[model samples]
Target: MTTMTTDARFREFKMPDVGEGLTEAEILKWYVQPGDTVTDGQVVCEVETAKAAVELPIPYDGVVHELRFPEGTTVDVGQVIISVDVAPGSAPAEAPAEAAAPAAAPAAPAEETAAEPEGRQPVLVGYGVSQSSTKRRARKEAPGVPAQESGAPAGTYYASPAAAAVQAELNGQAPAEPEAPSARPLAKPPVRKLAKDLGVDLATVTPSGPDGIITREDVHAAVAPAPAAAPVSRETTPAAQAPVQAAPVAAGARETRIPVKGVRKATAAAMVGSAFTAPHVTEFVTVDVTRTMKLVEELKSGKDMQGLRVNPLLLIAKALLVAIKRNPDVNAAWDEAAQEIVLKHYVNLGIAAATPRGLIVPNIKDAHDKTLPELASALGELVSTAREGKTTPAAMQGGTVTITNVGVFGVDTGTPILNPGESAILAVGAIKLQPWVHKGKVKPRQVMTLALSFDHRLVDGELGSKVLADIAAVLEQPKRLITWA
Candidate 1:
């Protein structure tokens, strides 16, 4: 039988590591599906790693042939999630006998080329695979098994268990029956991990994703206990002394359990690590910020600060920067591995922002070198990007010091925890009009509290005290920013 070969027309696209050595990402959305024409550099889907949300662009132009995984599925790097037909409209002389096999297969190889030319497949974001590591040896087919009925395609490395079962059926051998469903529950790796962590059985959970796939929400809902029954109202009781029966409570009405993953998961892990590993010491001081508030209003109308976000946080960030300048020793990290205290010359000023994802601290690269207006502009961009959930992993790294404005939530001063690897964190409380002794007379003044938390291993009480005092001084007398800086 003559079989036309059109496999060379198809090309597979593997999931690329979007960030620094990330292993996997959850498919947030898909922009294209099978038969959709896509061009070079066209975004195919959005994926979320532990760090951030990233959109992936297709490298070459083609008509999409298959989507291996659906949305909300977390796929590992180097796994083929998509396949495209580079030559979609090519005519074939004869169709192969095993044409129905590829349709039923979940992971069908696109090509059967023996050798991989150097850089034939381009990896996204400059993370390329080695030329020698790109190709795999073909698996030997079992006796009496057709070429397409083999466990895997020629030169293909990976084959799932489901693919193995398909091979058995193609060979006319029925394998042993399964205890649960005929096929295993459809779920990604991370969702499986979450179910395992929560001690939930995937087979017992009702799947809500497309094609009967289990989602993260489904896993969470599986373990959610039914709400407690409400007490019977006394006025509606048939008899005052009769036994009371509880009213039925609706599901998920009283509380909600949000599964911690992605950015929130990373943040929670980092916070727990920082709290236990580092020896923290927090110092508090209430200061009169009447001068700083006035300065903020003045900078708003100034030509230098035009079109900038000038608020108490702006002046407060500047104040903290000036304080760091006064005490450079406070800008250091404790290297436990080397048993050394590494002091930083440049300061990446971190601003803690709360988003729908979670709290993220994105920092300005070098706040010490920037002018007031430049600092204001950088701060504006940082806050805006963080609020929109576009803060990249690189933006949250290498921070020397941080400022968390709890005042925005109308909170008094809090004992802030030190961000991992950073020396200190400053917490700013709400600025309220309070009666205070100003110029030896009682008057209503703009007052706020400042709390400084630092790693005692690198910053002693004396150094931490000086840094806190300098910040307080800068806020009390705004002119001290120039003198201290």
Candidate 2:
């Protein structure tokens, strides 16, 4: 048998759907650029989707040949963004110039030479090279002046078409023929839009991109020029000038507008959907959590929970889990398509965390099987990761129940909206000292309010009340966690 070697070819990497059914993602940053050698499973770029920031890893080892899109560009799913040469030693594919050179005469015009097709190979999955001929839009040139000068000044001269035509008529010369459109500076659609919006001419802006392409930074720099001193005016003297009045400020002048793109957009859409689709019934209960607070202090000093997050929220989470075990029917979802109730045997408990980006719920998988210490550790890690904005999309999916602690913000209580696809959500309020009737007498006790919101379709008033009552009962009597759980 004879062994044969294949030629080296370029491989294109497309932007993948990072999140569940995500259609697009913004390129946050690129770790590797062109000519950078990358290995398999090495992260090359970071993209921000509607859910979270995701780091994309290259699938194979190769030398990067081209980067199709720059940073901050929003690319659609399955669009090719990067190309790499897998085999560096092999000869590259034949250039189109060599094939077209013989067909055209040796003295062909520069326009014909510039119009040759770029025969690039299709290397991305589900994408192929377009077979149609590439045509360039004709750029309307000034009628009088030529595109280039034989000997001009050091700096390149650029003028508007109207100005050039006016100057040519004054010089008493006929307008020169237009040049090829390919001679114009190269730029992406977004960059051209930015230049137009900033009132900056692309012809006067020097390009800093690869292959003489114009970039956003180049356009911005052209718009912001160095300050020059204004000439002193002798016509209007300071003594003869009249007093000027200050104009009134408009409304919302100091307000800043932030674009809704990533996690914030997803959160807004989910809240609107949940509020309209589900019949939300919220019930409030003011409970005495003096025992629960004392238990939190004891656990903080315990050897098992020393380094973990030991707080009222930790005990409250355990209490809710215990309550779920008592009332398993509450841990379910209503399937509209199937017209049935989907009850989950396991619990993926979600904790609503407020980060700099927005509110995100990262859940602890299999919370029903973990002990108190394990639960505390998981909560600690979840809070830490959420604060750093490193929570993955998988951590935010498939949650059966969620807990939003408004107490941290000093809020008394709130009717929290249910997370999408979840059956119930619990809100914990600020714990304060208040006089309550205990043992037939009014005494000072640590009291806190709990709000439970549920879908009325799946959980009736009785079942929802039972779950909330069970949670309050466990918090009031801390020993029930051991007996009920």
Candidate 3:
């Protein structure tokens, strides 16, 4: 048998373009640190692009050698973020004579010694290492520095090396004391927010998740056994008596400033561009959806539709698909550069979902080909994935039409802006009981309003009106779905 020897080959994993043509992503958190052994296909870090949060998996097995950037740093595509030593037992490559002569060049700059590695290595599909001149800029402050001295703004936290050293010196002269844990408990942002809302201390609760990460269940359990305490009166408190002076006001007490980034930023830019570029015209129609409501109830208890989400939105989506089929001209996009109107044969239906990060419109591919049950299942999975913040960037790309259900929020109707590339978007308002003139009689009926917004360049007034009227007709009479489709 041949013996194997350690080979000192280090591979660098670069930040990839997680979304279609995306240029950058902010490093949210790191799952592996230096000296940690990682396997192939194991997620090492999570990054947030303009579209969604994506977990990147390492393609090769090795020990992590270094993390090039800290958390919350935005890195560009093709820039190396982590280096791994594939062969741990082998010796590292020797540096050049000029680089190694520390005594000879005592005044050499620190940055000159920290040059990036030469050459490229393949890491993932559609992404290979390249010798791009792109580099991460120097942080305003170095790691482990006091926030004020390091030039960090208020409301930000940073570790101070000088403070730690001073504390260590004092501890040597004083009596022995027990050391406290340095790292905080592991928990996601959502879980931490939940714990704060419930007044549950994460450190006191027991973590049952993998790697000691505190989960939502742990926070709920901690809150369940606590006894309700009586409120304290300020007049009877000793601290309240001593502090008669006015308290200092924080800078953000009156107004909060949220950074514009990720999905929210992209959405804002797209809305501004679409509103000004595309001459939009909105048409509204009020229709009685009592029969559609009855069909929704019927589908909920059906054998095939059981365990799936069967709501008015499902039928409303089907109705829009049928309307598009009837008026095929409404399902088209405008190409400004080519000065052409491109009509699509397939329908990629987009559903606007409000996530914690912001609004994201992830679509279903080939939605027109799916049956009612299939559409219901796909809608269920899409909403669930969007809520969990796991919707991929690919899922949100390439759409022909969209639907936004403002009805869920008890609104009558809205003129929604079209998605950047798509031609039309439909807004469905709340279904309410109202007096209607049905069959020459004033009776209470379930009525809803529909608004269709389209790019006037390709879809004229007649086409937009037809699409909206067809959807209203389908909802008014549910049987039209079979005949029209």
Candidate 2: where are CA atoms >4 Å away? 1-8, 87-91, 95-252
| Pairs that clash in candidate 3 | none
Task: Give Cα-based local distance difference scores for all models.
Answer: 0.69, 0.70, 0.70
TM-score of every prediction relative to native: 0.69, 0.65, 0.68
**Candidate 3, after superposition: displacement of residue 327 in Å?**
0.6
* lDDT, model 1, position 39: 73
Model 3, span 1-485: residue lDDT tens: 21222212355677876655578889999999989987766789999889888888775566787888898988887777876654454434344324333353355455533454564322232123322322222122212221112111111111223223323334453322333424456554445645775688888989987556676668767884322222221111111112223446787698556678888899899999999999999999999999999999998788977677777888999999999999998889999999999999878899988765677888876788778887877777677667666777767878899998877778999999999999999998999999999999999999999999999999999989989999999999999989988
lDDT of 1 by residue, 1-485 (tens): 21223353355667876655578888889999889998756889888877777677775566888888999888888777777654445432134323423455444343433345543332343122333333322222223433323222322322223233433555567743322313457654445645775678999999997556677679867875322112221221011112223455678689555667777788889889999999999999999999999988888798866677677887888888888888999999999899999999888889887765566787876678777777777777676666555666666777899988888667888999888999999998989999999999999999999999999988999999999999899999999887777
- Total clashes, candidate 2? 4
Model 2, span 280-395: residue lDDT tens: 99999999999999998888798866556577888999999999999999999999999999999889899987765677888876788778887776776666656555677766
Decoy 3 TM-score against native: 0.68
